[model samples]
Structures are given as structure tokens and as C-alpha cells.
Target: MHRPALRTLLGARALARNPARRAMPTASHYHRTSNEASTAMRQPSTNTPRPPSRTGIAARIAHQLLAPCVLALSLGTSMSSHGAGPAAAPERPPAGTDVDETRTVAQRTRAPADCLSVVLEGVTVLLDRSELSRQAHAKPTQWKTEAERMALIEGRRAAALLQAAAPAQGSSPACHPVTQTLDGDDQFVVLAHLERGAAAVLPAGATQPVPSVAIRYLGQRCGPLCGRGSIMVSIPGQPQPFMVTHWWAS
Candidate 1:
């Protein structure tokens, strides 16, 4: 082996033995690989959730704040609708009940009327409870002078007696006529009338109070000794035709 040839052969053998050195990674390569690895680690995994953005966070907060307000508004609407329902109608009093407060004062919008335009002797006549103050004697607003009805008189004994007065209602306009009438679907039922704050009681020998009306009998011929009676206007929560219980008449 000559000197130059020997050196060349030795170099070739060294290269072949350390073949990985020829492809050995450099400092720049290591740095670049390290940077790539760090970048990949910093990136989020596909399954991982991202932090909410400003717009998303703002939207979520707004929804939370408005939820209660929307609920409250809906509740208020429901309550108001319920509250606006119709009012209940007045119930009728029992039959054969009556009161006889027969006087008056200045009327109010809902004032009790003391007059009735009724059929007496085939003529529509006006019956009224007039003011005692007309005489200007200041008779205590209303003196309690009820008709002593121990033995209830006959309401219809005289032809002039009211057909049905036990169910008379309080008069408004202070002089409205009372009549037997009920309101149902534009149809009418005849109801008797009793003034406001009127009630009835049992007769002399009777034990318990009877739901009856005290009716007055007035007429053109039946003078001095007028007629009065007790009548039933209702029964067990049901409206009844005027029933004459006891009476006295011309």
C-alpha cells in the first residue's frame, strides 16, 4: 500500500463505520425541532374546549340577567288576566220575609227608592214612602214604628194587595217600582221585592223564625182597617212563588 492510497482507504472505512454521523442532526436542526414540538404542545387538543370569547361571555351574561325579568313579566300577565274576571251576581233572600221602613230623605246614586208604581183597582197608582221632614218636625231620621204582626194578616184578602211584595228589592232613583222579575239570558222571572235591610220573623205561636214576607194591603175601598200578611218568598235556597201564610183583608 502506497501512502496516499492507504489514507484514502482508511477514510472510506471510517465513514462507512459511522454512517449516522454523515446524517447527524445539527444545532440549527435541533433548535428548529424543539421549536416545532413546543408550538404543537401549546396548541389545544381537538377535544379540549376553548375559553369563551368576549361576545359569547357577554351573550351568556345577558341571557342570565333577562331570564328572571321575562319570568316575572309572564307571571304578572297571568295574574292580571285572572283578576279581570266577572263579578258575582247578588243572591235572592228567602221567601215570606219583609221589613216595613216607610220613609225617606235625599236620594243618592244608589239610593233606596220609597215608591212603587203599581196596579191598584186596575189603575197604575204610585205608592210611596215620603219624608216625615216634610212637616219639618225633625222626627228622628226614622222612628221605629213597625206594624205589630203577631198574627200575620192576609196579603191578598183585599183585591188591592200587591201580587208579590215579599220579594221586593231596594228601589233606586228613590222611587223605582218593584216587580216580580228575574233576569236570565234576556228572559225574565217574576221576583218579589223587599227593601234594603229588610227581614222577616215568625208569627205569635210559631216557634222558629219563618222565612216569610210581611206584606201591606192598600186599596181605594179598604180604608181604616187595611190588610197585612206574612208570605214565603223562597224555600231552601230556591226561589218560590209568593206564598200567603196568614192574612187579614177587606
Candidate 2:
């Protein structure tokens, strides 16, 4: 019946008396529970959400086809915006190359004719019959009766020849009956005569006529000194006339 037996009997009596009183867990048990909780925290969780699954073959094929198209579209857009793409250049012929010889010759030939027409037209205006007669009579020189009569007749004839030879509507020929010679390269000397040594020489260009005192004097000198009647006209690109009149007073 000793102390151990008595202690056991007292513990049983307490348990019966306090049914609500529970046994406290040991420190080892608490340590084991803490280890289990730590392991649970360390391990990866399966409850986390997973990524959405892709359409296996169809998605891969679509990506493969669209990748090149997207890359090409982006490259084209960049090139167009920057203006860096190479382009074909227009072809140009070498400098000083003659394209059409025929056309060039035709143009060269046509220019002289046009200049000639201008000369004829200008001379015709200057040598009007009544105007020339008036100018002749107004001069200070006194001519013999026969010479004065001849001068008037020659002036009328010169005027008539110029008017008849000039173009009625358009361009006239380079060698009209009134034109004597066409001379010079850039400028032209136009000479026309109605009587002996009675001539007019004017400088004409493509557009304008220059006044010549020599020619005016020649036109006026027909009263006495003039011996032979001759006309000379010069167009551009021709030699100057050497002898304007065939005869002069001896």
C-alpha cells in the first residue's frame, strides 16, 4: 500500500472530479506540429491558377504564317515613311547630241526666209511712190528737166516693184524681183534700185530695220549722177554686194 499506490488513487479521484480539465500537450508534440506547419509553407501550392492553354497546332501555324506578313508590313511602312527605297531614274541623252539633222537644217533654212520677208516689208514702206517723189523734189539739188523727169519716173517704178514683190498676206521669197542681194551672218543689208545708181541699202534683222543715210542719199541722187539702174538686197548669212550699181557718170 505504499506512496505510489496512494498517489495513483488521488490522480484518478481528481480526473473524476474535474471532467472538463484536459491533459496539456508535451513540448515535443508542439515542436513536431511547428515543423509540419513550416513544411506546408515551404512546399509549392497546387491551388494557384494555371495559365490558359493554347490551341496546339492551329495556333502555331497561324503564328508561322502571320509572322512574315507582319514583318513585311512593318518593313514596307518604314521604308515608305523614310523614303529610302531605291527607284529607277529617267534616261537622259548625252549633251550636244544632235537629235534630228533634217529638222535642224529646215529651221536654219527657214530663218533666212523669215528675215528676208521682214526686210522686204520694211523697204516697201520706205519707198512709197508719192513719198519718194516728195522727198526728191524737196532736195536742194537742181536737176535738168530731163533728169528730173527721169528721177520721178524711176521713183514710181521702184515703189511699184517693191509693192508688187512684197508678200500679200504672208512671208515672201528671199530673191524677189526687187531684192538685189541678202548678206551678213547676224545682220542683213537689203539693197533695192529702180534706176541707174539710184538704190537703197538698209540693214535689216529678224525683227528691226536700221536707218542708213548712205541709202537715203543714194535714193535721192538719181536726178543727175546716177547712170545705171540696179537694186541689191542682202539677207543674213550672205556676202556683201561689191558693186551696187553697174554704171556711174563718167
lDDT per prediction? 0.32, 0.34
- Residue 221 error for model 1, in Å? 77
TM accuracy, model 2: 0.23
What TM-score number comes out for model 1? 0.22
lDDT of 1 at 36: 100
Instruction: Tell me how far the alpha carbon of residue 52 in candidate 1 is from the true structure, in angstroms, after superposition.
Output: 4.7
lDDT of 2 by residue, 133-185 (tens): 34334433445774454344333433344454444344342333334433221
Model 1, residue 53: what's the lDDT?
Answer: 100
Candidate 2: residue 233 Cα off by (Å): 9.0
Poorest lDDT segment (10 consecutive residues) of candidate 1: 150-159
Q: Which stretches of model 1 miss by more than 4 angstroms?
A: 1-5, 18-22, 26-56, 76-250
Q: After superposition, which runs of candidate 2 have C-alpha atoms over 4 Å from their true positions?
A: 1-144, 170-205, 211-239
